[model samples]
Target: MSEQLAIHGGKRSVPESFVKPWPYVTTADQQAVMEVFKSDGIIEQQRIQSEGLAKEWAEYMGVKYCIPVNSGTAALHMSLTGVGIEPGDEVIVPAFTFWASAAAVLHHNAIPVFLDIDPETYCIDSDLIEAKISERTKAIMPVHIHGMPADMDAVLEIAKKHNLKVIEDVAQAHGARYKERLCGSMGDAAGYSTQASKTLSSGCQGGLFTTNDEIVYERASLLQYFGEIIVPGQEREDQKYNAYGLGWMYRGDMFSQAFIRSQLKRLDKNNSLRIRNCNFLTEHLSQIRGLKTPYVPNECEPVYYNYVVGFKPEEIDLNVSPRTLRDKVQKAMKAEGVSMGLWQRLPVPKQEVFQNRIGYGKGCPWKCHDSIIEYKKDDYPKTVEFIDSHSYIFDVNPPNDLELMGMYVEAFQKVMGNLDRLLK
Candidate 1:
């Protein structure tokens, strides 16, 4: 038992701090933030950088327009609102994503129909999406969950057949591409987050709304910043303060915009490094009997937002359930100085917020005019099986120092080398 337990005085494979540094800030980032303060013109003086960054992001993603907002949730709301999702509307979304994806649907007094994800890709199962579509299904919000692009080709076809709009929740994927085309560019409109942990971080909280459709683009932009719906540079001064409808102060601040632009300079490089690290770890981890690496598709180039590893219960001699085995393995790994994390514990529909019908209780959104979804346990059995027991995330980043990745491989190997602790 001592041989299998790092906590019980076995040798630790990694250093005390194995976590890759986050918000990888530099002098340029500090200077950029200072410049925002020095100018005292948050949006007015730095408008060029703000506008330039928006254009730059759109161009990089191969989209026609980009709207910079305060958060990914804001962009999502704008996407749904832009595409005319209203009260009682239903948006089909993967159950594996952040709360924001479904929260946006509820934001508009609508319902989010949760679908199971593909165990291999950890993304929305395109095949299963069609089964869940109903008359209330207004759109398909396929999240590129964990940076791997969902089956967009299949998703798009499903959307088209159902006459539904497509809104890609691209919060985790920045440079990720599906079939050589970027993730954000494929949907009718997409939302991106520059939250601190995201691949293309804005150095602070930020969001972007992108689309090729001119009308959707226009409406999205207006919805973010006070609904000042007017063509840029053509706004008459007489209507400077004219707000046509309900709009929130959702635009990203100038400081965030400036830093995001600076970070954009090395976005691709960072993603490349992350990809290398992930691939290297995958190669090494696959050798261990119980560990499973991420499944990368031939047509998809994922960004590796969260490097997830799956646990195959049957392959190993550990008698415990997959969940218990993963917990013990992760504990042993952490003792060996590796930072491991749990992926989402519950599928979206099974979350207490959804099952309890928090928003639907008043019979408002969840109990909308059209859809009343009763979320149940094990509704998405496949999704639950994959995540609840089979998977755990390694909190890694696209580190500039490649050698640190070796330590991760060693730590994982050491933990897996001793499975006796997990055996009942």
Candidate 2:
């Protein structure tokens, strides 16, 4: 390794040309998509590909029912709606997750009560949830962000005590398990995303809603298709789409549906490889001072959707902002050919949609509620800290060739060890 920092003219470690995941396309995948195109029924009545995919996914997740939708956001909105969350009802969610997780609450004219996250896991702090619960509290939507399962046992116990519905936002955690129990199967209903870049990518856009409860399944099923009713015993293709009430057109596309079936065959294997790479990265990085590696509880078997590393200003003993040192490290790491950066800059409440109350004219849900809720940027101290610092997320699904991971190890070792030069 060079003594000079990469930014100060040391050689790069990893090669930019090293590709990952190699787009696992097969001849069968090509034929299936091509056939769909030639059939002249892109939006056919049956949606066989979508239905079959949904059924298979149901078994994969160990849920009795799975409803395939156009996107993860749709799955969440329908799930909450199916669970009977109405306007004025409040759902507790993490302030530090993707907007879609909280936005789904807004979609149904409900209020999303954002809570701070557990600093170690970067997930909603189960300890803080009870404080936010109220009469209007209807559900607890715990997102398994970056594929690290949230403390489901704590969340479930809290929900049971308070009579709140539990919705697992498993968009990034396709294969994650908690204490031998699968993630999506733990909550009353769980949502999944198989869009491009997800653990189970279809090279397109898609989502799934899974649940064990029969009533919840039926409700979400009808809600996705404008309240369309399906008669029992009819084949998926022969079922009548009897529309009765208001619903969103959250139907899944045929190509994406068939495309994901190919990806499912490799989802578990892909997750295993990701876990190994993550362990390798963590083992090396954990030795560095002023740097935090991803933390997984003993009970969790994470799929590693993201190997999210953290850098807290308070955790570092330096007087200057951690961002200063973080930038130096990142610049040198990039120069060393290791990609690292923040995923989302702001937590949900800090976004303009929440700050300026600019969602859907008059901020219907935020202000439309009987008791208007006030949002302060500093209310969630931990989430704000995460936004201000803790940048850079590592993709767990690396290239087909595992050698890039070796480069990743070398890159971090070189950068962190050369901090004296980096600070200069």
Candidate 3:
């Protein structure tokens, strides 16, 4: 273990961190691509690879149908459009998430009603969702943020009672299970991202929309194309005039489909490795004071995409800001020959795109019970408090050898040893 640590923390390697160099791309993936390349079929056409990949993904996700798109954002847009979310409609989304979650709703001319998240799980607070729903509420897009499954049971119940459509954003969670149920299987429809950073990445980008409803599935399929409902005897000329509804060119390419299909096979094994690393980190970090690891539900099995650590500034008696702490830790790690820093930059709501009146019309309709919601500095007491003290560790593709895991553990311990000094 010590020798492995030395190898990982080489002479040129900085102190605070070292990202696992070798990425996991199985041989099966390469073979899959070669098969596609050699096949005498339309490489860029949507009918060939996209449809086939969608079918296979549907089976993998245990859904009746899956619609493959160019990107996850496109999938979300299709799902919202399929559910008939139009202008003036409001969709409830968590504030502490990727901007795509809210932006997708805005794209369809629907408003996004931002909701607070549970401090522990870091998912939208299910209890607060009911109160946020109004007459204009059309859908609830709950993102399985950072691979941790949201309170789907509660979210689904509320959706049912309110007669609202539920669109599960399974972008961060591909094989995550809540009480043995897959993340994509819980809602009316779900969106999965095959972006480079995700578990089932396609190297470039791709997206999948899964659903049991045949009508919705068909609508989403048509939306991915130019909304032309493919019919018997309707050739290219006739199909142009027989447009079904508004649509976008969000079709996935043959190459991305081939790569994603190959990567999907090894997702479970990779996720298992991530879980093992997370367990080790959690066990070690739990013993330390003033730092809290993420809380995973007993019934919920997360894929462990990004391991977040919360620092209790009050407990530490440190006068330094969260940004300061983040910088110092990262610098220290770099000095120790580590190769990483904090995961995320800032919270979603804090971004200039959300604050400024750029493409997104007047302003967002997000509000909190305690304070008036302003995009700039309007006090998001909970959000601000959390972001100020929180730092994250990203565990991407873990080292193939388990010995490297021990090196990470030792490096983490070394960083924590002088935590007080680093914060100061």
Give the Å shift of residue 274 in candidate 1.
Answer: 0.4
How far is 56's C-alpha from truth in model 1 (Å)?
A: 0.9
Number of the predicted model whose TM-score against the real structure is largest:
1
lDDT-superior candidate, 1 or 3: 1
Give the C-alpha lDDT of model 1.
0.81
Report the lDDT tens digits of candidate 1 across residue range 1-424. 2244566587776766656576687788788777878885554645666687889998898888888888999999999988888888889998888888999888878888888888889889888988888888899999998899989999999898889999999999999999999988888999999988788887669899998898898777778878786555443454567787777778777878888888888899888888888888888888988877888989999988878887777797656677888788777777877777686777888887787778746766755474557677777887888876655555567553457778778777767766664453
TM-score of each: 0.94, 0.92, 0.87
lDDT of 3 by residue, 1-424 (tens): 1222233343432333345543356688788777787877554343566667877888888898788888898888888887767776888888788888878877776677777778778788898898878888889998888899999999999999999999999998999999999998988888888988888888888888888887777788678778777643334555655667777888788888888877777778888888887787788777766567889988789987777777654556767666566566656555555444565445666667666634344453332112133454452445556666666665435653345445555565566566754554
lDDT (Cα, tens digit) per residue for candidate 2, span 1-424: 3456566776778766664543457787787677778776556623678778878999888789888888999999988988888887999999988899988988888988899999878889999999999999999999998889999999999999999999999998998999989888999998898778788877878899999998888888778877887654366578666776678889888888877877787788878888888887788777767777888899988887877666644554666576677777777877887777777777788888888877667767766776567678888888877666665645446444357777777777787777666776
Ranking by lDDT: 1, 2, 3
Q: What's every prediction's RMSD, in angstroms?
A: 2.2, 2.5, 4.5
| Deviation from native of the Cα of residue 169 in model 3, angstroms | 0.7
Q: Which ranges of candidate 2 are over 4 A from the true structure?
A: 1-5, 21-28, 38-46, 231-242, 312-318
